[model samples]
Target: MKSVAHVYPWDIIGDPGAVQRILDLGVDAVALAASYHTVRAATPLHPEHRLVDARHAALYVPVREQAWGGRRLTPAEPSWVDGPDSYGQARDALKAAGLPVYAWTVLTHSSRLGDLAPEVVVRNAFGDRYPYALCTAQPEVVEYALTLVREIVEQGQPDGVVLEACGPLGFFHGGHHEKTEGGDWGKVRQALLSICFCTACAARCTEAGIEVDTLRAQVRNAVDAGEPDSVESALGAELASALAAVRTSVVAQLRALLVGEVRELAPQARVIVHASADPWATGPFATAAPELGVEVDAVVAMCWPGPEASIPGIEALRKLAPGTRIAGYVLALPPKPIEAAAMRAELAALAAAGVQEFHLYHAGLASGARLAVVREALDSLGQRP
Candidate 1:
């Protein structure tokens, strides 16, 4: 089994000991953020500064005018981190230390871009715009995602690429100080609310033989009634299935375009996606429906929900893409105790459930103690690659 640790450019840029600390973790590679959304990250072990407030979504690489010329949805350069090419600088240092690097590219999750172009963002069933989610149903958003990937592969020259939010984002916006929990919405209601009714999406659904207004009304009525336990129940079987087909189709098209771009740019680079087997899933881990035939080197399932939730997801993904490796996106941060035994058990459980890779989350933000626990857990699992 292989192990890859997630990190940021700021984690490596000014910290002399960053490379050595990462090496000590026994990871085979590092998934460094190439393009990322807003975050006030904590550099627990950096020598220069402790906190980095990335005020907006920005590309870590230098934003070339030629690459983004005439494009309205171009990526912004990071002002929080010093230097024009933080990704390049960090990539060079990690490569020098003999650690393979994967460009962790985030797509369709930029609030800054969405705010600038409201029409391109996701509009819910009630026509409420999610300013944080760039609706992939829009042609401009698709073009932006492709351009971003092209830049990362052509410039960053990574050994691999890990794609996040490769499809349309829905109601979830983590960093926006969300206040929706007050409504007491269940998982079913949340999924319903996630249904996009934007111009492009509605058109797509209509083309797929769905009544746009009727479906929207049904969605609203479902929310009001608050009776249905699942999306299928709320929208009725036929409508629900049709809606899923449309959603999955959108995700499938975007994934293919991005993956094709990556393959064309660098055939040797491994392609990994943060994904879910569930057809209705959205957000960072987009749906990797088996029927669509996910074409990637690996599928990384979010394992922060623990073994019970994560194991089944991994199993489902394994069945979906049997040829591709399954990676557990394991979390070692807060809410998860900094203990080797506990962490090792989770890793072991995932491995047993057919997870061929372990993708450790946030090596940059983790404290020395937390990192130590990660190292110990990997050591225990014999996962040092």
Candidate 2:
């Protein structure tokens, strides 16, 4: 199995030794964050780099023009952009080190864009807008994402592209020190709340013969009542099934568009999607359905440890997309604790379960000891390359 590491561009800029540090980890490829949402962070190497800390920000590489031949996506100079040319610099450095660079592109989770264009953001059944989650139902958002893919490929020139949040992100964001209390917001309720009711989504449902109004009311009632019934069952089984299928189709259509665009723009670069094991694609990827038959080089299953872990996801994707490769995204920090033995075990398990590549999460955020643990694990397992 190929071993890969995920790194933020700032991680490379903040530390002079970042490239060598990652190379020492024995990873074959580096999945660099190309487009990202707002974030606050403190870099281990460059403590002075105070661009994204305590404040949510999007890490966007400035492009000269939009790939779709539309108006340039100029984000007010400082709203969404982080550093100019950082992606190119970091990518070149990694490639020079003989490490393959895959642009780890985050597609929809962007508070910056959502804030700039509230109309394009996802709205719940109650018309409550989620400023952090950009709705894919919006053509403007889709255009922006296509432009991002083209620019990242044309500018950064990555060997591959790892698409994350390629669809609508769910409501449960990892806000700092989050705290909430209420009746059990189980999977069913969360799923109900996750259904997008934006103008475009409603139109799509209507086109698919779904009663948009009735579906919205049912979802609102389900959330308000805090009940745990299958979202489809509550919405009437046939209608629910149709609506769910509609959502899946919506995502599949978008994925196909973007994938086709990538092929046309950068046919040489491999496409890898971070997707759920669930065929419906309802967890993190509320709209994305890899099973929609979009051709990807690999499907990534985020198999971080726990109840919602990746082993099941790997198993599912292995069955669903048997022809494509399965890459396991593993956590290398706290809770998982960057330990050699643990890392080795996880790597071995994923490989045994049909994972062809292991993408280590955040080499930039990990401590030196953690990186060392990764190196030891990779070395001991002989997973180099």
Candidate 3:
């Protein structure tokens, strides 16, 4: 099995010992952020500033005018980092230290772009807009994602690429000072709320033989009537199936186009997608049902929910996409105890469930004690092949 550590560009740009620290952790590669969304990240061990407030989604590399070509949804360059090419500088430094780097590209989860162009963001059933969730059903959003991928691959020049949020984001915006928990919206209601009703999505659903107005009404009624057991239960099987088909197709097309662009530009680079087997899942780990039929080198499942929940998901994905590598996106930070034995146990359980790779989350944010636990756990797992 292979292990990859996740880090932000800010973690490496000014910190001289950052690469060495990562090397000591015994990870095979680093998934360095090429484009990222808003966050106030904690650099617990950096020699420079300890906190980095990346106020918005921005590209770590230079936002070349020629590359964007006057697109209204162009990415902004991060002001927190010192250099014009933070990604490039970090990539070169990590490479110099003999660690392979993968350009970790975030696709459609940009609040900055969504705020600038509300027409491209997801609008839920009740006509409420989710500024953080970019609806991939729009042509402009698709074009923007393709351009982002092209710039990352062409500029960063990494050994591989890891694509995140490769499809439409849904209602869950974690960092928006969320305050909807009092509504007691269960899983079913949350899923219903995630259903996009934007013009493009409506047109696509119409093309799929779904009545948009009636479907939207049913969605609203379902939410109002309290949570059902599942999405299919709330919206009848026929309607749910149609909606799922349309949403899956939207994600598949966007994924295909982006992957195709990567292939054409850098055929040698390996492509790994953050994906889920569930047809209704959205956000960063988008739905990558077998029916979508796009090929990628690896698929990573979010494993932060622990082994009981995550192992089964990993198994489902394995059966769905046979012959492709399956990775567990394991968390190494808070809420998880700073203990190597516990971490190693979870990693072993995932591996037993057929996980061929491990993607450790937030190397840049974890404290030294937590990182030591990560290093020890990885050491217990033995060397990567």
Candidate 4:
């Protein structure tokens, strides 16, 4: 189906006018980033506006701590988000939307720097705090990460689930190992890595006779101290494989745990991966993803570099998961606001890509006039009958 996936704008989520507001535009499915619970979370631009109390069909959830927060999402505390009641409301709202709400969780990213819960923190070579990626290698972490997903499935039984990353959600490979998919040290030093130097991970590696410490040191020296060849000849394949294994297993467990639950509840549920779609994308992820609930339906990749980026991205998606739906997560669409000439150009390029669904990244920062512009954009996208 030809639909526009607009990012749930902050305006819509936080306002009473949200429902009909986007309807005024013509877009159907919205990714609605942020705004996971009973209300919408405030953004820097609109601080006073607490999350609006609304009924939505599709909702996005954040399960980690980056700019979003600094803790694991749970039925209590920071993770509870508005309250566990919010989870139920979230699902109900999505049902109202006649859409499914997927928990866009980041499994590996843990925010606490040091001495955090063993199940949550990712370690470094120096035994420092690279507390980002949860050591999926550990059974505890696998069980822990699925806490919210299980809740969502059992309690909310929403529609489907999407992913932010196989690991964390920030500049993914932005700075440390930005171009390259990250190694143990790169991950650990970024203070956001998901390696587990804990006895558990080492033990597993040792059983395989893999010198966990030596490999860890190689990664650590390269990442922590900026050692050259830190990445070069640094056994990226092995490290990547290990990390991927951790992530894969974590997802696999999640699938093992949730798949049945989902099928029992919403038999036709879809599992989408929210990850980057790149060509030179290095690291163990490509090989490792299938380990997680392997039956992923689609991936949501954004259009930051514009339409040209979409071309390669779509190509990458085809390679990664053929027949998997590609939700082109675009930003800055007009009508509901967030528009620009650059966006227009990028959109033109995306139209050229083999995109089936155009998922606008969000719905926010809009006025009636802007929403009007969004309507125009949609009509332009698919000659609205």
Candidate 5:
């Protein structure tokens, strides 16, 4: 509780005036999905105004995949500035009133719904493009991403740039499958869904002389037109080598991109990442250290609570970037007393584990007076509780 109270965006449906009340309760900031990411709706804005209510919110900007406004399409250039002069303009306007603003960007998550981006999107071994992804393996993809972040930084001038969850999509065989809220990413084996097997990804692996097809074949399960799918016939030999190559290359690239920027602009801004788990875990998350040039002071881990509540990741975070402080993520969506308790527990555990920063996913915790609980937590931090 010795740090600032960080939180999410308040999506006020009917009465917009209630936001101030929410912020009054120690909800130091708001992270919002600024605009929908769609082929048609290039830049995200509320339609009425492109600028988010920055004066009242701490921004965790929700970046869209290629397409956001229903249609799916990936622009050669990132479409974040169609509405405002720059994302930083919104940040600056908000900071005028003493707010902290960071460019909150997502990583390895390019699937929208039906079909948005195909080639430039996240694809499974099956080839069906998920809604939002830009293939992490493609050099072109990295270039586009860097260009956009640089634009936001050079023009927007945010307090810091946050890279959230950077890692390869799960691994797969000859290719991969996609997963949805529904189930399996078709043709692309069930194992391939969360995993990726894009040709570009394979090529990246091949450069290291790994067998791309062998890795792809390894994840393929035997599927009987009449019987349930089984992994018995699926999976190939010599696949791990290929999978390792893809994962390694992707992580290295992300780490380099993020840290490189921080080094270039450390005095003007910071380049950081938010990895609580999965993408940020060890092996898969080998990029957290300064070797990759990550901004240690600004890099933070959203150490949230799990059913079992392990701290290996947090400890790893501390070890990965010795000086970076972690902000344990407090889930506040429903705003229930139980959730508050969980947040409290997470904070307690993380702090005890030596984490100093705390970031609460704003939307979950800032509803009505439920945010009052957050205030209680922050008051304790400020020597008030």
Candidate 6:
């Protein structure tokens, strides 16, 4: 099976030894995060030892012009101590080390732009704008995403590009010292609140023969009453089916847009997408997989498992898109055991499930021991043909 590792550009710039250390891990390819959203504290080893505040950061690499395809795409704030073109530098260094690099691009999930243009943000049934999640139904958001992909393909010169959060991001966000309380909220409730009711999205639904106002009111009532499961039954099968299809279709169209843009702009670069096992509420895997076969080279399922974690989604996806490659994205750090044996078992199970490739979630944030676990797992998994 193919062995790949995900990494942040800061890790390479921050730590002088990062490249060698990664080479030591024995991965077949490296997935470098090209365009990422905001984060509080990140340590890039360039200046050595000091923690850098990378809040609402943009391209880790120095962009030649702040604009992509004549549109002004935001860059990471000046707080980044490294040079603006850090991405190119990092890719060059890794390439010199003989490791292939893929651009791990994140399309949405940006609070910085959302905060600046609240009008483009995703609004729920209650009309509360999620200041972090940008709605793709908005034309400008799609344009920016296209520009970002075009720039990465034309400039970065990566072996491939891995797209993550390529569609709308849900309410779940990682803020520093996050806190929450009250009822569990559950999957159904979260899904209800995650639906975007922005004018653009509503317009698309209307075009699909869906009554946006009625659907929105029903959703609002379901969420308010804490009766998410009852939502479908209340709406009746016909309306429910229409609403579900519309919601899923919105995300699929956005994914198709980006995939098409990349293929047209950078035909040589391989296109792999981060597809979640459960593609609902805020993701696009389930509904988009069939159409994606025409564009995507492979689907990397986010199956970060624990000791007893089961990956039924792998089989489910295989059935949905029979001939497409189904890769597994494993978490190398906490929430997952750091033991090499546990990690190996997880890899073994994924391989058994007919997963032809494995992409380790992250290499930068992982501790030395955790990384060692990853290395051990790769070593045990043997080589990919």
Q: What do the candidate models score in CA lDDT, each in turn?
A: 0.90, 0.73, 0.90, 0.47, 0.46, 0.74
Q: Rank the candidate models, highest lDDT first.
A: 1, 3, 6, 2, 4, 5
Q: Return the lDDT, model 2, position 31.
A: 92
Worst 10 residues of 4 by lDDT: 279-288
Q: Residues 1-385, candidate 2, lDDT per residue (tens digit)?
A: 6888988777776566888888888888899887776666546655455344425544446656434345533332224234677777778788888999998887787666677778877788888787777778788888877777777777777888888877786556633465633546776776676788888889989999888888888888878785755776667778878887777776777778878877887889889888774534543443344363778888888777732366776777777677888887778888876568877777777777888888887787777788888888788778754
- Whose lDDT is higher: candidate 2's or candidate 4's? 2
TM-score for candidate 6, please give it: 0.90
Task: Compose the digit string of candidate 6's lDDT tens values, residues 1-385.
Answer: 6888887777787577899878988888899878887654434333475455567748755565556435543645345646666778878889998999999888877878887788888888888888778888788888878777877888888899888877787656534465633646666777777778888888888998988889888887777676555446646678877776776666677778888877887788788986653545464233353345455778877676542454676776676566889888778867877788988888888888888888887787777788889888888888532
* Least well predicted 10-residue stretch by lDDT in candidate 3: 168-177
For residue 152, give model 3's deviation from the true position in Å: 0.4
Cα deviation of 168, candidate 4, in Å:
5.4
Q: Residue 357 lDDT in model 3? A: 87
After superposition, candidate 6 runs with Cα above 4 Å error: 41-47, 64-73, 174-177, 277-279, 283-293, 307-310
> Model 1: residues >4 Å from true position, as ranges?
292-294
lDDT of each residue in 1-385, candidate 3, tens digit only? 8999999998998889999899999999999999999989999889988899999999987899998967999999999998789999999999999999999999888888888999889999899998888889999999888989999999999889999999988877554778999999987788889999999999999999999999999999999998799999888999998899899888999889988888889899889999999888888999987553777889999999889989888888888788888988999998999999999999999898888889999899999999999999888889433
Score candidate 3 by lDDT.
0.90
Candidate 3 global TM-score: 0.98
- In model 1, the Cα lDDT at residue 167 comes to 90
**How much does each candidate deviate from the true structure in C-alpha RMSD?**
1.0, 2.8, 1.1, 7.4, 7.8, 2.7
lDDT of 4 by residue, 283-342 (tens): 213222442235566665555546664577566665666666766666543322345444
